[model samples]
Each structure stands twice: as structure tokens, then as C-alpha cells.
Target: MMNSLDISEECNNAFDKILKTRRSIRFFRDEIPPKELIEDIINAGLFAPYAGLAVENKEYFRKFIVIPRNTRAMEKIVEITKNIMKVKSEAFKSEMDKNPYLKKKGAAFSKRLELFADKGVLGIGTAPYYIVIAEKRGFPPVQQQSLAHCLENMWLKATSLNLGFHLVSATAQMAEDEDFSRILGIKSGEYEINGCAIGYPKENPSESSRPETKEVINWIK
Candidate 1:
């Protein structure tokens, strides 16, 4: 029979596995996650800890916009993203001309952009669902930290649900474009923090490299 300590250790191990196994999947199968699952994931964000005693009154601080598969909106997003990539590629090349150190990196980046434009190789593929996480404009640093906490919770929830999750930062550039924001129905004075794509994975992604804990952490005491 297992003791309470053993049960506690088991729980810790399980949580560790979840953290280790969560990968940012770029490709996904064309299946839409169920409505209930999406709700559960959003609820996980809702329950995340926020700053200030007025937490109950701060619902407006965070918002989630969901885009389902193959809709006109999704197509618009994909097109806009492609245009943004093109602009980024040009900017990368211009910077490479001024900085020799960036030449190698810029070449690789431009190659990827070519694949994305010509071969349809997306950094974040056409996942069945996309959730745009937005925050009210002019939030202070603490509240912004709270927004990040909310996203981390949603990511963990997606991992626990056996779904592929990819955070799409490229969309933030699109959010800045006034026309694009209008298409997405984001009014003025709101900032798009980032986006998350969710779907069944096309393949299991390999583990990414990470720096050793000792390299990144220090103990003063």
C-alpha cells in the first residue's frame, strides 16, 4: 500500500512529465477540437491568478477570440500572415547587408520565409482553431505579468488534454495593422498579446534544446 508521501511524490512526477512533454507543435491535423474542450481550456485561463484586489471586477483585462477551421476569417488571417512574413524577409535582408554577423541567420530566415510563401510550409500551420489572447490597452507591468500567467495556465490545460499547442507570436505583428485588426473585430485601445493554435498533431515533435538550470539560475543564499 502507498503512503501519503508516496502519493505526493507520484503527483509531482506526473506534473513534471506534463511539463516536459508539452511541445510547440507547428503542424496539425484538420480536426476541430470539441466546443467543451475549448471551454475547459479558456476556463483554465480564467482561473489563473491576477494582480490587485479587484480581480473580480477585472474581467475586461483579458479576452479570447476563437477562430474555427476553414472560415473566411481564418483565410484572411493566413493571407495577412503571409504578407507579414514577406515584409519581415525584406527587412531581414536589409539588416543583413549592414551586419555581417546576421548574414548567416538572415539567409536561414529568408529560406524559411520562401518555404512558407511558395511551398505553404507554415510556422504555425492551419490548425483547426486559433485563439487570440488580448489584453486591455495600457495595463501596468504587474497586470501584464498576470496576462502571461493566464496564457501559461491555458497552455498547461491544452497539454493535459492531449492536444497540440503552438504559440503564434507572428500574429502580434498583424494585430498592429489597423485593417487587419478591423477584420478580426478588435477595437481600438486593445492590445493583442499573442495567439495560440490548437489541434491534433500531424506528428510528434522532437524535444527542443534547453540551457542547463545552473546556467540560468543563481542562488544568493
Candidate 2:
């Protein structure tokens, strides 16, 4: 049995470990973590604070689930996603060229945006597992930002396990593509807002950059 003190100590240790090694791993080993472990991580996300948990009488709340695909299969799916993005990039470039306002953003910005629309998505390359979290908005927008918090927990948890993880919100591009949706069993109008790529880190990684917490925190009494 875990006493209060023991639990607190464990929590602190987990947090320290997480902060130390939670790098956004872009390169992944070929080995995949066990499917059950992946499911366990998603379960951790389900416990995250959301509107559903905030109110006992709320009429609606969102349900979440994760899908675990092997590295090879995920690679194939990513290829399809890349093809769709190429078409989207061409369209975006054409639109930006037509609008003088967009042109003012600078060629580098537009080019990077096009590249993001092209290859910034690392869903399959980084992690052998893909965890997609979605919700039903009842056809109208509702405050669902809480889902992000839930995902953050999963990302951090993966880090604690010495597994690398990063959220790939750019999966939204694939969400809009019909072919991609069909492959993932996603329906229209449903928000597949985010996905996380998770796997073991490579043998040697570049030094990580650590940001000062003060930049993100503002104290108000």
C-alpha cells in the first residue's frame, strides 16, 4: 500500500524524471512498445481534467480513444498523408501568391508554412504508435480546450516511461482528407483535433534545449 508520503515522493520523482528527458523525439527506433502499454497510456489521458469531469449534471461530454498501429503500417498511412499534403501545399501556395496580404508575411514564412503543410507531420516517423483523441461537438463549437490538457498528461507519462512523445496537431490536415479519414475510420464533422507519436528514443540524440519556466509563468497574488 502507498502511504501519503510515499505517494508524494513517487510523484515528485516521476515529475523530475519527466522534466529531464521528455524530448520531442523525431527519430525513433524500429521497435514498438507493447500494445497494452499504449492502451494504458491512453487510459491515463482519459483521467485528465475535462468539462465532462467538471460537472456532474452536464448533458454532454466527450469520449476518447487511441489506435495503435505497427511501425510499417503507420509508415504506409503516413505516405498517404504526405501525398494529400502535397496537393494541399500547392493549393495554399497558389492562394498565398494571389493575395498580396499573405505575400507580405515574407517568402520564408510562406515557404515554411508550405513545408509544414508538406512534411512537418511526424506521426509515423517518430513513434510506432499513434494515439488519436477526438470528440463530438454536437455540431456547434463548445469549449473543448480541456482535451489538450488530457493529451499533455499522456505525453508526459510517455516521457516518464523513458519513451519519447510529441503531439502532432498537424494531423488535422489528414483529418480533412477523405481518403485519410476513411483509412482511420474517422467520420465527417467529428473533430480529430490531435494525435501523439510515441516510441523509444534513438541510441544517441542531440542535446535538448531547456526553456525557463518564468517565460511561461506569471505570478499574480
Candidate 3:
């Protein structure tokens, strides 16, 4: 017979285990997450509290285009993403050349693009599901902030569900570009500010590194 203290200790241990096992999980097993489970994660994000005001507004007026697991669709997305990264790198280099002050930052940005290029679009060739979270209206003050907050909530929910989420800022840039924008049906001009790749963890390769602590957090008594 287990007492209340023993049960509580067991629960705490289980929770710690979950946290320890949780990593970026670049690779994943080949299995599609259930539709209901995905919906549940989104719903959790939708219910997140607003910044301050009680404005009841939907994040996305249009439907989220869930790209199928087809090779053609995946290849198209990868190609688009690659081109977007190239364009951004070129633009950044051009800007740096004109402004000497921005040279250091430009070099760093170019390096990131090169590293991401090494991995390509599907993120280590493991992510099977690509969720393009797009919002309709890209204006105003409150609405924009609200939408960003919604995205943050969604990312947290994804982590809690043991799913891998990699934000391809370059993909969002592609969403805004002239040619690719048409594919997303974004009013022929609107832009997607963010994009995330979600899927189960794979096993081909494992483990990714994160930066150690910076001098950001300091507790006061």
C-alpha cells in the first residue's frame, strides 16, 4: 500500500523523467500524428490568454494549408525554401556591402543561411508534416501582437506534446515573396510572418546542441 507522500514522489519522478527525455528531436520515427491529437494541440494554443485586452479575435481567418506527405509537394516546398534562403542571403550581403557597420551582422546571417542549407527544408530529412500557420490580416497594432502571442502559445503546446517544432523563418519569407505567395493564396500581397515544422521524433540521427546560459536571468531577494 502506497501512502500519499510516496505517490507524490512517484509523480514528481515521472515528470522529471519526461523533462529530461525532452530534446529538440531533429530526427523522428515515420508515423503521422493522429488528426485529433494535432487539433487538440491547436485548441490548447487558441485558448491561451491574451496579452491584456479581452478582444475575441481568431488568429487565422483562412484555413491552415496542411501539406500532404507526397514527394512532389515536399520537393516543391524544399525548393521554394532553398530559393528564399538564397535571396535573403544575397539581400543581406548587398546591404552589408553598402553599410560597413552592418558587415559583422551580415556575415553572421550568411553563415546561418549556409548552415541551414546544409540541412535543407525537411529539417534533417525527418519531418513528414509541414504546418503552414498563416494569418490573414497583416496590419493594425493589437491584432498583430495577438497573432504573435498565439504562435508562441502554439510552440509551447507542441513541446508539451512531445513533438518536434523547427521554425523556418526563411519559409515565412517565401510566403511573403511574389511567386510563392500565390501558392499560399495570401491576397496576392499579404505575408506569413512565421512558419513551423512539426512531426514525431526520428531515430536515424539523434541529439542537437543548444547554447549555454547567458547573463540574462538574475533573481533578486
Candidate 4:
């Protein structure tokens, strides 16, 4: 039998593998994740630490809106995202025209815009489930930080369950549009901070580049 230290090291290795394998999935199969699995992921989010002690406060409320395979709702979201992409592309093109440096560096941005147009949505994938992370407007930065932790917990949980997960930050703008906000069930004073797409991945994506620990960290004596 393995020693306790060996067991601990094995568990650590498994966690590292999960962390490394958790890529931002851009394509997913046309299938919905099990409701129980989604509930477990949400439970992970709920278990994340918060900033304040007041459980009743709006700031402490962890709000998540799940849209599971709703064709009409997805259609509306896609339409709004397409409109936003159009406006952004036009704005970027205008800026690029004035600045030669911007014109050179913005090739990748232009390509991404084209891809969004082709996909008919801002998200990286056509996931069967879309979750909107919303919070009360004008909340403190600490509250936002707490929500971020909650999201990370959910991401890890999804990865452990062999589910695809991708953060869709671009769709946050949808919360500003009255009709889109209404469709998403966002209250008048609430703001959509982030969004995520979840489903079973069609393909396993390669790992993305990252900076070395030495470059990103500082050692203090």
C-alpha cells in the first residue's frame, strides 16, 4: 500500500492535470448537460467565500441565470451579439484607418470579428446552455471579487465533470440593451458582469500560452 505522502502527491497530480486540461472550449456538441450536473456546479459556486457577513444583502446574493437549450432565447441573444459585433468592427476599422500602428496590430481583432459574424454569436461556441452572472449595480469591488471566485469554482467543477466551459465576456453588453436585458430576466438595477457557455465539447482544445512563473511572480524574503 502507498504511504500517506504518496497518496497526497497523487491527489495533487490529478488536480494539476485537471487545471492544465481546462481550456476555453470553443466548440461543443449539440447536447445539454445533465440538470444534476449543472446543479452541482451551481452548488460549488454557492459554496465560494463571500466578502460581507450580511446574507440578506443584495450584494451577497449569488445570482446566476441559466438558459438551457431555449431556441428562441438563444436566437435573441445571438441577434443582439451580432449587432454589437457589427458596431465594434466598424469602430475598430475607423480607428485602424487613422493609426497605422493600430491597422497593423488589429489584424487579429478583425479576424475575430469575422469569425463572430460567421458564427452569428459573440460566444466562442454554440453551447446548449448559457449562464449569465449578474449582480446588483453599484456594488463594491470586493463583492465583484467574491463573484469572480465563485465563477472560478464553477469552472473547476465543470472541468472535473468533463464538461466544456468558456467565458463569454463580450455578451455582458447585452445587459445594457433593454429588450435583451428583459429577455435575460435582468432587473432594472442589476448588471450582468459575465457570461459562460457550457456543454459537452466536440473536440479537445490544445492548451493556450501562458507566462512563466518566474516572469509573473516576485519572491519576497
TM-score of each: 0.75, 0.74, 0.68, 0.75
Candidate order, TM-score descending: 4, 1, 2, 3
lDDT per residue, candidate 1, 1-221, as tens digits? 76646667678888887788788887888777898998899999888886654344565667788888678877776776677678777777788899988986668777776665554434344788888777665534454566677778888888889888887655555556765677667874466456788888889866556899899988899
Worst lDDT 10-window in candidate 1: 116-125
How well does candidate 2 match the true structure in TM-score terms? 0.74
Q: What is the C-alpha lDDT profile of model 3 across 1-221, one tens digit per residue?
A: 76646668677776655445445445556787777767766675566554342232544453455554556666666666677777777787788889987886668777777655555655523476666655554334243455566555666666668776665445555545665555555554453445556677664233434465465556688
Model 2 over residues 120-198: C-alpha lDDT tens digits? 4665455677766765444234324666877878877777677777777766556566655655666745654567788
- Total clashing pairs for each candidate: 0, 0, 5, 0
Candidate 1 deviant stretches above 4 angstroms? 1-10, 49-57, 98-107, 110-125, 139-148, 205-217
Model 2 residue 39 lDDT?
Answer: 69
Task: Give the 10-residue window scoring lowest on summed lDDT in candidate 4.
Answer: 51-60
lDDT of 1 at 78: 70
Candidate 2 deviation (Cα RMSD): 4.2
* Cα-based lDDT for every prediction: 0.73, 0.65, 0.59, 0.74
True-vs-predicted CA distance for residue 137, candidate 2, Å:
2.3
